[model samples]
Structures are given as structure tokens and as C-alpha cells.
Target: MAGRVVPAISLKDYESRREEITKQLVEAAETAGFLTLIDHGITIEEIEAQFALSKAYFDLPKEIKDKVPHNLTTNNGYEYYVRKHFPFLAVLLCPIKGPSTGSIDQKESFWLQRNSEWPSDEDVPTFRAKTLNFIGKCEDISNKVLTCLSIALGFEEDYFCKAMDTHQPDNLSQMRLLHYPASEGAQGTWRAGVHTDIGCLTLLFQRDGEDGLEICPGRESHSSFAVGDTFFPLPAETGPIVVNIGDMLMAWSDDRLKANFHRVRAKESGHSPDRYSIAYFNTGRKDVIMQGPLKKYPAITCNEYFLHHTKIQFGHNAKKKQEAAAAEKPSVVAATA
Candidate 1:
């Protein structure tokens, strides 16, 4: 595969270079559907501190982490591998295996939304305060990107910003902290499965040297599976945030933008190191209706769109779980006999 062609655009003098930045961002969205942002105002120190906090949270006992288990209604709090598919069941019971590898993503995540009730600071000192501060920085960058995209798509500069207003009670935007545990070259396993972000935009921060992120360029379908696509590596590098277009944004643009498939796979050779990354998902508020000027698709509320996408992503998994359960029933009956 060719080395990275994903554009790394600078946000330096953003006010002065709005037109140039907008052009570059729109171009990347149309082609690669992924790009990196440098000089975007968040310091390396701040990023590191947030990573530290993430580690501290993940280091806690499973029971402690489970205290804030992810809520399906709100899409916030802690979640283990494929837990979102069967919120009340264990991974063994609901194995949402990936199509290519037939293995579950070996990762856990903590999601935070604007109105999420954070984990107690007593568990991880200043976790709430520090995380909220970092989230604000991420939101600022996300809004700026949204502004650029708005202008590129011929909408008012604040159109997306207003639709995704952070202060709104129904806003669904989220900051996710992800941890992929170290593995001893587990065959068929992946840190994450191939999928596209479900929201409008995503800003991702990865720790240097923990590379596994890859993307399949030129994907035309909105489906998470890459049918005939080739994947290319996107190494983890500190400082710059990797940004990508998401399903909602593509729908909002009437397919002008792309939401490409991406994944984090296990290394083929040696042991795979533990991986850590943070992502800010910019989703429109629940009540906000999304439809581009071209109206190529049906107009839908953000909440309904999210539900439709979630069903597409995990509906098969639920069916598979039932089939697996049925297949195991005979064995259990014989063993009991």
C-alpha cells in the first residue's frame, strides 16, 4: 500500500487562512475522507494529561469501572467489547464477531456526553474537571471544522454549529476514551473492527508508536464493511489530531462528503502493545433534522438517524447471538443428561 496520502492541514492563523483551510478540508473530505489537523491550539501537554487520566480510569478494577456501565438511552459511560449490542449480556454470550476476522474488538471505552454524569472524582482525582476542560478544547476545534464545512457546502457558517450546540439538552456529541489491551499475537483479533464513525465529525488523538489505525480510501458505500476496499496504515502520532468525516455528515451533505471504513488490527508478528486513544464525536442534537439542500435522502431527526445507523451496525450481531445460543442448547442438554 502507498504511504499516507491523507492531508495534514494546519490551522495556524485560522482566522487569516479560512478560505485556504476550507478548500483543503473539503478536498480531503471528498477524497480521502480523513485528514490531520496541526497547530490547532491544543498543547501536547494537555493531550498527555488527558491520556494520563484515561489510564488512571482504565486502571481501576473492573467492578469499579462497571459502576458507570454504558447507558443505551444516553450512549454514555463505560462499555466493554460489543457490550452495546447486548447491554446486559457478557461478551461470551453475545459475540459480535467482525466479518473479516471473526473476533471481537479487544477494547473497552468510556464515553462522555455534554450532560453525562461523570465518574466520581474520588475514583480518579480531578477526572471530571480535567476531562471537561479537554472536551471544551476539542469542541472548539470541532466547531471550527464544522464552520469550514458549512461554507464549503454553501450553508451559513454557524449552521452545523447551531445544530450541534453543546449547551443544548438533547445534544448527542461525545468524547470517548478507548483502551485496547496488549495481546500476545492473537490470531484473527483486532483492536477495533472496520467501521465508520456514526456522527457528523470525529477528532482522534492517538499516543505515538501505538499504531494500528488504518483506513480504506475511495469507499463509496455507507456500510461499515469494506467489500472491495484496500486498507492503508495511519500510524499513531502525537501532537496532530486525525479527523474524519462521519455518516451523519455524509447524509447531511447529500453524499457530497464521504465516510470511509477504518479499523485497528492486531500486528501480524510480535506482541501487540496496549493502545490508547481519544475521540470526540460531533453529533447533531436529537431533535435537529438533517437534510442537505439537494435532498437526495429522506429528512430525519438526528435521534432517528442514530437509531437507524445503530441498527444497521449491530442488528446482525443480535441475530447471530440467538443462533449461537440455539446451537449450544443441545450440548447443554446432553451434558446435563
Candidate 2:
């Protein structure tokens, strides 16, 4: 028989029978570090509408889209028609930069954060209204899922929610709209190079496609499946948003749970069509210390790992940028010559 399908949980079901469901969720997390969630209570119609809006926005002329070019100033908001490798390599908490370290993702991305307060009527008009509604729905799902996480980890219902509350200003949620050009004769590993997410959690809504996603489960030993060294393709399912724990969650769990490493390989040479996916990233509060829950698992802090990795990876990138800048300087070139 084929492998067991990944378990999908509903928030309502979880709440009514928190004890049993929490056990299952925690067990699944410990083993897989990822799970597909169904009946998250978000409707497919809403998801489809959001996708339509994203497509409309992306379809705008590149010149018009450039008005909101991605920049550090607005926390990299509204990336449009941009092609570049992942930024903040060090901050991403990966050993090797990533599968797409040097090469760029074959798609454009747009970023957005949680609005501090509801936007006024005039700023975006219809756009603002739809965005706020979408975000509200997403936030509800996030809160409910997080509550399950608390229960799964044997913490009081409000533990993580309260800690996260203080960092509401830095919710840093992102709505990334990706458009992968038609792969007629593409020569590469995949549309999005192999990489794991950096945030605590990722919620994905992918457009129509038979298959593209792949996962390489973390291995307990050096010798294991070939996917242990590379990404293994995962088939797309009809419902239940694909949810994966990222480096942040692994760190928060104090090694109890792992961050799933996954990647996408381009579709069959002749059959691959353009692909699109919108990912809703739930970035933790900037200053919220992600320590292991009290009286849960071994005592450790996500902050410790974050600082450790950040210092190493981030410092390296900063140095590289500095070196590149120096090399580009006219005076430096003249002196060298």
C-alpha cells in the first residue's frame, strides 16, 4: 500500500477534544516536524479570492509595480519583478546558505507585514478592505493553531500567546506572491531551490498543479534515505493548507521538534507549466525570547540558537558585502592596479 497520508487537524475539533488531539499533534510534530492542517476554518473561496487579488496586483505593468519595490526601509515590502537569491542569509539559520544561495528563485515575491492598526478608508480603498479581511481571517487561524501548539507542548493555553502579545508590533507577517514562469526548457534544480523556511511556521496556498513540492525529512543518523542529503518531491493534495515547522520552531522546541528541510524540483521537462503559490509566513515577535516552555522538554532558548547562527551567518554576509563594496571602490581599484 502507499504511505499513510499526512494527518490534518481541525481547530474546532481540537478545541472540543483538546487532550486527545493535542497528544496526536505533539506526536506528529515530534516525528515529522510538519503536518497538513484541514478545516483550519478558512474557506477555499476566501483563499481563491486572495489568490485572484494577488494575480491582479502582479499582472500590473512592471513599471507600475516598481512603485513599491522591495527595500530594507519598509522591512522589504512589496517586492515586484525582482530576481535575487535569498537575503539575510545569516538570519535564516541554515548551515549552507540555501539551495538557491547563489542562484535566484525563478519567481518574483511581494512582502507585507501585519498593520499596527486597521488602515483608514482612504489609503487603499477596496484593496485595504480585502487585505484587512484576509489578515483577520488568517490571524484567527494562527491564534487557534498556536493554542493547540501550547496544549501539545504541555503548557498553559495562554503561554505562547501572551509572550507573543508583547511583540504584536513586530508580527512581521508576510504575504509572498510567487509566479514561476513556464518551464519549457529550464535547466535547474527547480523553480524555488531547495530550502527550509526560517520563521516559526509557514502556511501555504499553492495554485493548480499536479506535483512540485518535495520534502527531505531530518535524519537521525548520517546514513539514511537519499533524500536525507537532498529534497524529495511531495505530491500536492486538494485541501488542507500545507504547514511546516521552520528553524524558529525547532529552536523554540529546544530540540524536541525539528525544522523540516524541503525543496521543489522543476516539473517534467515537457509538461511543466508556470506555477504560482502564496505563502503566509508567521514571523515571531522580534523581541520575544523563544525559550523552551517552562517545565517542558529540556531547558533551552530559541534566542540562544538564533544568536549563535545569526552571529555566524549574518556576520559572514556583512563581511562579504563590505569586501564587495571595497573591491568596487575606484580608489581601492586604482591602489591595487
Candidate 3:
């Protein structure tokens, strides 16, 4: 069977045409698990400006970037690919690793929350103010999307928004600035591994001519890590933002929605250009419990479910490394003897 085509929905006149938009969004979420959104209130110029700022931040020296290392507890700050390994406890929460490759993702990222401390003006002058402003814009879009999803699920329009309230101290919604450096000759490495996002919804912005995003939508309903043999390319372009459902929403909708497997594969020629993209992950407050009205799945708190889902998604990589270390220990003893 042919793969589903990702639908594009317009957010123009959203206030007046909300019911129509909600149906389209829910249909896309149910079938393709992804969609392209246009006229979503954010301008192309604003997106490019944020992309430029992201490049400047990633271009800084490693030492400077390291100043604001990632905090496992808060899930904020810079994370370089080379130093991607997490503390034993943190490994349970880090879900970027690829199950097939048994290696870390090739890209680096800077995670930002509303309350996160900004980089100093000396390092990047406009970074703080511009980024926060952009985040607010993205949040506006997110809230609108969430409102639609809530109405589709037979709840009040503000139901999901209240659960993901940014003002809450434990809100987990965040924006990420990602940089996938050019891989001119690297082989057997993925820019990003195959996995489903753990949040409720994700808004992704990508540049033109830098295509690598692929999705296996046929496996959308699969509960495990298995994927279909055929994959479909979801090219990156300007103007429209790519939006997708995530595990949290899938569960919240009692499988009525999908959170399909996706990844960034290397080009056929083994060469890839530098790729920069921005992602806004909208998650519920840590204390909020998520479960569908139908009660198909057990209710679980946001943070607890995140950890549980990541463990199922990336736990094998940790176990694989441990086994390899254990196997090498006997050889080292023999060499010493």
C-alpha cells in the first residue's frame, strides 16, 4: 500500500474558521500523523531570523557553549553530540539515541524554557530577547493547535491549554535550536535516529533544499519500535511549518492520534549540508495526568510517563553499552595474566 500524504492545513482566519480547522487537524492526526501548517500567524522573516540566531549560537567555540551545559533535572541548556552520554540516572530521560545504530545522534542542540537563563549579551547580544520573543510566538501557535485538538476530543477548548500552562512552575514545554553539521564523508551515522517524540505536539521549522526528514507512517499504530519497509520523505521548505503528534497525545487520545517513527537519513552520496532547524515541544506540566476519556490506557503523570516512554524507546542503547563493557572485561583480565 502507498504511504499517506501529509496534509497541509491553513490557520488563516482561525478565529472564524476554527471548527473547520479542527476537523482537518484531527483527520491529519488520525491518518498521516503529520501535517504542514500555513498562515499560522508567524512570518517567514521571523523564522529565518531565528535560524540565523541559532547558527550564530552554534558557531560559538566549544568552551563558550559548554558554559551552559544541559541540566538533566530541568531539561534545559546546550548539548553537544560528542558529549551526549548522560549520567546513569539521566540516561533514562535522554531519548535522542538511535536504537539501530547504538550511537548518539549527530546533531547538537540548545534547549530553552520560559524561565531558562539566557546566554550573556557578550556571547550573543540579540540571542536572549529575540529567542524569547520567538518562543512566545510559537507558544501562541501551540495553544491554538492544542485548543483544536481538545475540542476534537470532546473536551473544552481550553482543556489542553490549561494542562500545558506556561505559567505553571512545572511546565515542560520548551523550544530547541538544533544544528546538524555537514557530514561530507561520514557513513553509517544518522543525523537523527528513528524515534517518536515524547511530548504532546511538536512544531518544526526547516530550511529549503536541506531535505532528509523521513517518516514511516504505516507504522503509526504500532506500539513497539518496529517500522515498515517503505519510508516516505518529508522535505523541508520555507513558509509552512511541519507539525506532528507525539506519544503523549497519542495516549491522551486513546490511540485516536498517531506518533509515528521518523528520522533524518544521510543523502545517497554520503554528503550532507549543514542543516539548522527549530523545534518547539509542547508538553503538559509535570504534575498533570494524561489519559483519554475512553480509559483505554492507564493514567500517568507527565514526567512519569516521559521517563517511562524514553526507557522503552532508548533503554536498549544503554544496555548494549553495558554488555559490550562486560564482554571486554574478561579479555582485559586475560591480557594482564
The most accurate candidate by TM-score is 1
Listed in order, each prediction's TM-score against the native is: 0.87, 0.75, 0.86
Q: By TM-score, is 1 or 2 better?
A: 1
Which scores greater on lDDT, model 1 or model 3? 1
Summarize candidate 1's per-residue lDDT along 210-322 as a digit string, tens digits. Answer: 98998877766454343344678998998999999999998889878999877787787788898999999999877788888788888887867877786655563445534
Candidate 2 structure quality by residue, lDDT tens digits, 152-233: 6667786556544423543445656677666665544456654556666677777556357766665431111123354455
Top model number, lDDT: 1
Candidate 1: minimum summed lDDT over ten consecutive residues — where?
Answer: 328-337
Please list the residue runs of candidate 1 whose C-alpha ends up more than 4 Å from where it truly belongs after superposition: 1-4, 83-102, 221-227, 316-337
Off by over 4 Å in 3: 1-4, 82-99, 220-222, 316-337
Sort by lDDT, top down from the best: 1, 3, 2
Off by over 4 Å in 2: 1-5, 80-101, 116-125, 219-227, 294-337
Clashing pairs in 1: none
From the highest TM-score down, the ranking of the candidates is 1, 3, 2
lDDT of 3 by residue, 27-78 (tens): 9999878999999988889988989899999999988998888765566789
What are the Cα lDDT values of the candidates? 0.81, 0.57, 0.78
Error of 2 at 134 (Å): 1.6
